[model samples]
Target: MSKKGPRLGEPASLVRMRVVPIASVMFASALPLMLPMIANSPALPPLGLLFFLCWQLLRSEMWPVWIGLPLGLWDDMFSGMPFGTAAGLWTLASIAIDYSSQRIYWRGFFHDWAIAAFLVAIIQSLAALIAHPHAPMGRVLGLIVPQIVISALLVPLFMRLTGKFDNFRLKRR
Candidate 1:
């Protein structure tokens, strides 16, 4: 007789899949604050964090409200923007991702990175314009271009690392 224990084809029985999403949210919430500390280098684009958040939301494995609120608060606190603004934008972005996830397939790393860049650019530009309307367009473009380029280059590696970590955790569970 064959053993009836958990088998490869058996459906996963675990109920609490909260750890991965929670950890991801916390990590993303903290990332912006850490960005300024790295000196003598191009700024890290916020898109990478945004991308991870979107990916987690699309997985549909957690309450977006729970994930969105605190992460937004964290971004607000760390970013020099008015309190709650970043959080609001981030929460909105997550909601948008959740709604569109079914139509969008994150198949290739480049595609994902491109989406991240576009979203990040839009959000950052909006924030900059809102926060400092008088700021020169040149300055905004200057800051954005390099960050976008760097993020575009770096996102695939970050995605791979995060994906690996998630897979490891899932396998262990």
Candidate 2:
């Protein structure tokens, strides 16, 4: 090891484990407020939230289920989704991701972004199914496909920027 107290990379590895967990909780709490802007934007998509969720999971930090439960409930209240529906789905997704963590190497940002896109698509489908069980599948697909693609494309850049933010304190220390 180098004589320096802890090299940049080493300190990052240590600090990330704690900091990421807390940040994820806060991010989830604040996410719903951003939905209106995202929903209204022609250029952006709903899956931006999923990108953040994916980052939270990939970091191998917090248990997303805990974050998801309350966050989803909060989303339901704000978004007018049936009570507990978003919470249930979010919690389930978080659990799924947590279980799959062992199989995936989340350090590859592109791969993580793809996964986020896939998850966003899945969420959209599930929400549509819950909200309108009678809606034609094609309509749901039409609504979701563009957003998923946009989210996939945007997630990597967002992840990079957010990852940079995570490094802010590390630079000073």
For all candidates, the clash counts are 1, 0
lDDT of 2: 0.62
Q: In candidate 1, which residue pairs get closer than 3 Å at backbone N, Cα or C atoms, i.e. clash?
A: 72-87
Model 1 lDDT at residue 150: 73
Reference-based lDDT, residue 155, model 1:
63
> TM-score of each candidate?
0.70, 0.67
TM-score attained by model 1:
0.70
Residues 1-173, model 2: lDDT tens digits? 55856555554455654575456545644556665554432234543255446556556454545666766776676555588877877777777677667776544656666667677778766876787678898876776677667766766666766666566634535
lDDT of each: 0.61, 0.62
Worst 10 residues of 2 by lDDT: 39-48
Q: Candidate 2 regions off by >4 Å?
A: 1-44, 105-107, 169-173
Mind giving the per-residue lDDT tens digits that candidate 1 earns over 1-173? 99756577654425434466556656765676665475443366664355455455335454554456676676666566687767666666676666656676554555566766666666677766667678898886676677767766766666666676566546633
* Residue 33 CA displacement from its true place in model 1, Å: 4.6
Residue 104, model 1, lDDT: 69
TM-score of 2: 0.67
